[model samples]
Target: MDTKKPYLAIILIQSIYAGMFLLSKAAFDGGMNSFVFVFYRQAAATIFLVPLALFVEWKSLPPLSFVTFCKVFLLSLFGITLSLDINGVALVYTSATLGAATTNCLPVITFFLALLLGMEALRLKTSAGIAKLTGILTCMAGVLTLAFFKGPHFKLFCLHHSHTADTAAASSSLTWVKGCFLMLTSVTFWALWLVLQGPVLKSYPSKLLFTALQCFLTSFQSFGIAIALVRDPYEWRLGWNVRLVAVAYCGVVVTGVTYYLQSWVIEKKGPVFLAMSTPLNLVFTMLCSAFLLCEFTSLGSVVGGLLLIIGLYSVLWGKTKEQRLLNEKCVSTGVNKQGTELTVVTT
Candidate 1:
């Protein structure tokens, strides 16, 4: 019922993503296999979600049909398995900075997919529409700047024995082009999940149940991948270590909570809103790393972060404006006319 609720969700989601970067990095530093880590993450998420879904959404759960089950399976495959797998591989071949830049394009991909699938409208004729589209581009530009350009060093709390100049150099394998392509592929899979889940959630309508099922299916899917890649039992062993901590944090906070929040947001605000929220992850990451890791930012980061915030707000205003116009139209028409016979958005 609130037009502003998605913003709150976006804030929380981005914070979680930022924290994920730090925690995932620690997990990797501790020599955790990415595949095994993913499997454990989904497995733990499933364990947590099962009881919650069973109890919380039990009454609301719809009968799972064959077609719906297939859809959910595809969702799990793309959303969890394929996207994370490709992302990990991409990181191996490319720098983490490049990977973040690649992910920054989520708004662009999600917006276009939403328009193509008729889930979101391209009201280019209106200022609000143009602002929304341009904002996505602007946000991408900001991220690109932050990723590629480091003007001058700037820091708020980074004085502990470290080189400031080399901060942009995120550790990665040097297969640049291959890594970029893989990263793009992962982004595509992620966007596919974002676009398709809106429709699936409409049909199924049980956020908790579907999310839990997706986690369960993803756990198995990840396990299969892990089996093919990881033969060492030591990698899979979750003892008292940072690897265990990462799994717990990622599973409970990132996947379990973040996925459910995103689903609920898509159901409420549409995928465009969810997609447009990605830039904030960079903002949060910048702040988190600066304080936590004593990492310093550059002039490019300062400029780009400002642009990112502006673009994000512009997009939000555009989307909200469209809703207002649609509401007005509905009131004038005295019927649910589906925004002038266009089902591109539903309130």
Candidate 2:
């Protein structure tokens, strides 16, 4: 696997997520129920991924075990249900700026979790460790810049529905403390899920099938939640509206494509690597908002984004360098080298 490919995948995924944020904000403004939207998104993702899984992993499909299904179910619950569904609820109660700032916590959360689980080492004395830490913190700073600073409106192109999201922002219902806690809950579980998925993917090793299974499971789970909250069947009705469009876009692009990409990245790079890529979405959001929504491109946002890129690259370079050194050591010591990690010590 080319080292650059995962980075490209993550960057592209981040850009898509940033654009999705704007589009979904518009849909939310148009009075779409978050729960219903989640159900639709999951349903759509299942529809898209199932076929791919069937065709690609058809021959190599691992036999389904109860334990594997259970792991996949837990993944669906945490990754989709808590991360996204609860995240939507948190966004409603919080300001976008606040949400953005806290959402940057994912990398930090995953970093600590991975370290504690022995999946990552904190060799603070090493240059690689220092670079990784710096990059993680730099990404967070970039998020802060995005959250707090909106410079003069220098954007040339603007979306037609930008005003809708603007109106939604204006009419936001903010409960700062409550929103912060809820946002924390969402990101914490999301980060947790990312870390846990590594082991699960190792055991499964069927990326598409696993992703599709998670989406398929989430579709049902979200539907049940929707039924509990929205007793009215009519509320769940789909129409040719922004809500429908948002669901379709989220289902196909956000869930279907990004899930597979994320799984592959996690399987290859580990959780911290995946977490590091998340803050890039904030950078994407700033640029997308400026260009597509005619929002001002703040100097702070630009500087922060540049810093974030530098930091992210620094981390990637550090990890790559560290991996190379580790592999060389393993080979020299007559230990087993399994790509990014040691398979066994033959001493």
Candidate 3:
């Protein structure tokens, strides 16, 4: 329950997620179909996590109640399948950095959803809450700035094809705008999934098992949809090339390993601290894109990214300070022993 450790862990996770975005973009640039990419990503994530869940939660795993199964299926639908599908599609139309920058607004979306659903109290009068609200708004502004403003572009590969309606949509000048909007929708679905699963997480209390179930369920759902919606293998564009590596990395490392790390961090620190790590993703993405993917940055993008990170840090700092004070006060009052306090902090 060392407060600082959670911050570090979250930063690490964010870096992984950001790198995943760049990798995803590369796969798209190679003409990989979004649906097929998601299908494979989920398939790989499921493969990686299934054995881990079996080993860890084997004895403790409860029999799958119909209700529990349905909830998990729904979580898979919104959080896993839909989010990945939309994000993958959107990335084909947008720059990697812009696609990732939009995700910085997820925390704000989650907070508002919590308030609307009565999961959290609207303590507008409190300085801590006010600071958090301001931070969220500022971060959102940064995301919008990145989306609407074309900072600069150094095109390395100018891809063109026989123009069709789909190609037209994908190659539209406002690709960033559409991508940002789609990413926002993905965030909304992801946030709602988190909110809906609060009770499930409490009841299950096994992150690995939940993650496995989610991936497995979502893979099947996505697979079914892919079969129905995508009739041509030519459209799938599956290639055993660099795009294959990108897909594998996203599936195994990004989805599988990152989820485990994120669950562990949340178990140790709490969701707010975990969420604060999101800005670090931007940093990692920028670095990886520039170095690994040969992406060039523009002045406006740099400023917008800095503003997003600053706003994100402000919110996390405020939350950490408030939590630390509460913990100290509890200790002073002997409300709980160090052991109990640690557990509370971990949660």
Ranking by lDDT: 1, 3, 2
In order of TM-score, best first, we have 3, 1, 2
Who is ahead in TM-score, 1 or 2? 1
Off by over 4 Å in 2: 1-12, 93-108, 134-184, 258-280, 290-317, 334-347
Ten contiguous residues with the weakest lDDT in model 2: 168-177
Residue-level lDDT tens digits of model 2 in 146-253: 445445424446655455335434442235345556766788788888799988897898877887888889989998888899887777877888788878888898
Where does candidate 3 have its weakest 10-residue lDDT segment?
Answer: 157-166
| lDDT, residue 302, model 1 | 67
Please write out the lDDT profile of model 1 over residues 178-224, one tens digit for every residue.
Answer: 66567767887898897899779988988778888998999999999
Candidate closer to the true structure by TM-score (higher is better), 1 or 3: 3
Clashing pairs in 1: none
Per-candidate alpha-carbon RMSD to the true structure:
6.4, 6.1, 6.5
Clashing pairs in 2: none
Clashes of 2: 0
Model 1 accuracy (lDDT, Cα): 0.74
